[model samples]
Target: MTRSPATPLPPPGERRRLREAGALTRDQLAERVGVRPATVRAWESGRSTPRGRSGEAYARLLAGLAGAEGGTGEDGARASAPEHSEHSGHSGHPGHHDRRDRQKAGAMAMAMAMVTVRPDRRGGGTAGPEPSAFVQTPPPSALPSDAPDAAADLTPAQAFDALYSFCAPALVRQAYLLTGRRDLARQSVERAFQLAWDRWPEVARDPDPAGWVRAAAYEWALSPWHRFLRRHRQPEPPPPDEDDRALLDVLLHLPPPYRRTLVLYDGVGLGLPETAAETEATTRAAAGRLLHARETVAARLPDLSDPRELHQRLAELASTGRLRSAAPPAVRGGSERRARFWTRAAIAFTVALIGATTLTLRTAPTRYEPPVPPGETVQGVPPPVAPGPLSEEERELRARLRAEFPGGPERLTPQAR
Candidate 1:
């Protein structure tokens, strides 16, 4: 027995045409099929192709419309003989299938490109190149308007875990690009998130909590401590591809600020002002660094001069090195960790201060007091002076006298005075 050939899912344009022909609004169709409007939009825009139940449902709808219009039915059965024969040549055309496949691939590429073109933080149109396919770029969706107040209800540990889960991978990827070492990059992200965990109350309440984490991650990745540590470790071999190795080598050789600017601007898709804020530089400085970085890369790789090509190449570089999400360092309660860190520091400081004070008191100079004989009423007295210059014979005589009689000097010392 032979299985029948599966029905082909309609192309995005065909699906749109069917919807228009049936006079069904996008939302209506989406609701009928139990999917979000966005999913329907994605189908129409060729950003996604439906599958399984959704695919069957779409095929059924199109077939029903085609049957009513006196054309092909669900099983590709033609209602009119002449029309079927006329379109028969088009149906078996292999070239036509290839063209459709290319269109679908192009659509998919365009969709993937839009994922990086985020809406402006200030609620503006999508920033970056004009997307080949249209996507509704909504405002940066926060944790809802009520999320800020609700976030406070969560314990610091819970808040931190949430932030870490949401933000760590992207942070790690950004860090990885900034520092050419994966271990250092991961350490940097973990350090930054740990810092965020410590300050969750402030971060959770901020307008853009993700921004805070990104800034911290970028700074930690580019810090001197990492650089110093990196010097002692054996350098890893270059990346696999020549282009990747050359680009990364050039990036590593750039000034730290420039490298960060490039990562933020190109790698992270941040605007100049935002990149500047993250890098702790003025907008003009960030722009200059970005321009310089691009020029440097272009000078080395001439193919990257085109803005579209440069953006695409940089995006590819960033994506190729993306780190798989790893289990984060165990999160202690943010409040507890912070309290413990500071508490330990304070205790150490206090112990050091007390020890210092005690040591100082013990070693300090004191007044010199002459010993008094027991039961003797001693008066303060001046010491007696000997003659200005004694002859060697006299010194020998005085020494001999002192040796013979212990009290001789006291008895004879006043005679010279």
Candidate 2:
């Protein structure tokens, strides 16, 4: 018995043709296409038609199968037919098919480029650039306003879990960038998440929960204790071997306010207004701080002429953890000891002054009598009375008499009588 010739599959027909011809099983096709078996069934049953690149892929798959079986090329045989061939007219010409394939490939390339061009989410430890460097253009379909409240009425643990899942790594990175200390970064991020957990309802209601957490991390980084600790602790500089040492040295010279402003603006690519919002300063003040910071850094690192180049360098340094190891010590041990001694001396002087003030206040005179004129009498003496009720005229005369002799009736009485 001779084997029958395999059925000639129609060009760009339903995926069922492959199933019937045994070119590919449903599972095999689904696996190759990276889709579920249910999707394969959908294509084969003609519930919906594949379009664009998907359709092209299907057509290519069919053409390869036909070529393998020693059949005429799907398009070659069709091309020799009448110009208005009924089968090929409505669908599209071979040239059109090739164009579509090219378009599909172009789109895929663009998508892959976008993915590859994106910044590294996990710092330079893995690969790629910093995530902040990417221009995040959110899709219109990604409107958070329409998203279900994933964080609504959640318990503290649940809220924290969600926050950690969404924000912890980003927060850690921001903290590390701001503080340039891994331990501090971890502390800052953890504290920020704790605070968010404490106020989840309010945080969940915010327009941007991630932004809120980021702001919190910044605040934690700027706290007085953190500042004090940074001042007192002599953190080792970033490796002197790194190329970014010059930049790090310049940044270390910047005053805290200026450094923070510059980092938020240049390192984070935030606008002046946004930096102001983040730093809790006025826009003009933020701009001035940033300007001063850049000026200081530029003066220190003249090699970094361009502000953008400096920013990129700093970002890379931060990503690589080389920036922290490159920082110059803020102050020497001798100077720190002198500062502590002066601080103690000032405290002692303040205590002495307070004691002296208290003693002076307690031992001062208690009497507060007012001085009297030479002729004035004390309250002890009884006042003299008029002999009788006087008319208005008599009252006026008595007043004049009193004015003339302040001793009053005593002076008017007969002498010694």
TM-score of each: 0.52, 0.41
Per-residue lDDT of 1-417 in model 1, one digit per residue for the tens?
Answer: 433225566678777778766756555677777776557757876887776676677667777865665543543353345555655564465355454343333333322322344445455676653221111222232112223333334445555555565556666666766778777777777777777766767876776777787778777777886545645276865665566677788888888899888876766667777788778889998889889988998898776676554544454454456465555446344336767989999999999999999999999778887788579666888788876988899999888886875644445444554
lDDT of 1 at 189: 73
Give the residue spans of candidate 1 off by over 4 A: 1-124, 127-153, 230-232, 325-342, 359-417
User: Candidate 2 lDDT, tens digit per residue, 1-417?
Assistant: 433224433533434555435445444565666665546555654555545444555556665765655554676466646643543463344344344334333333222222212233235333432243222223322222212222232344443343454345545655655666677766676666566655767876676566677778778876668656654387755633345566666765677678778776667555567778878899899988988887787777664566755665555455445212111111123334555788999999999999999999999889997788579656887789768877999989878877774543443446573
Candidates' C-alpha lDDT: 0.63, 0.56
Error of 1 at 360 (Å): 4.3
Off by over 4 Å in 2: 1-162, 227-234, 322-417
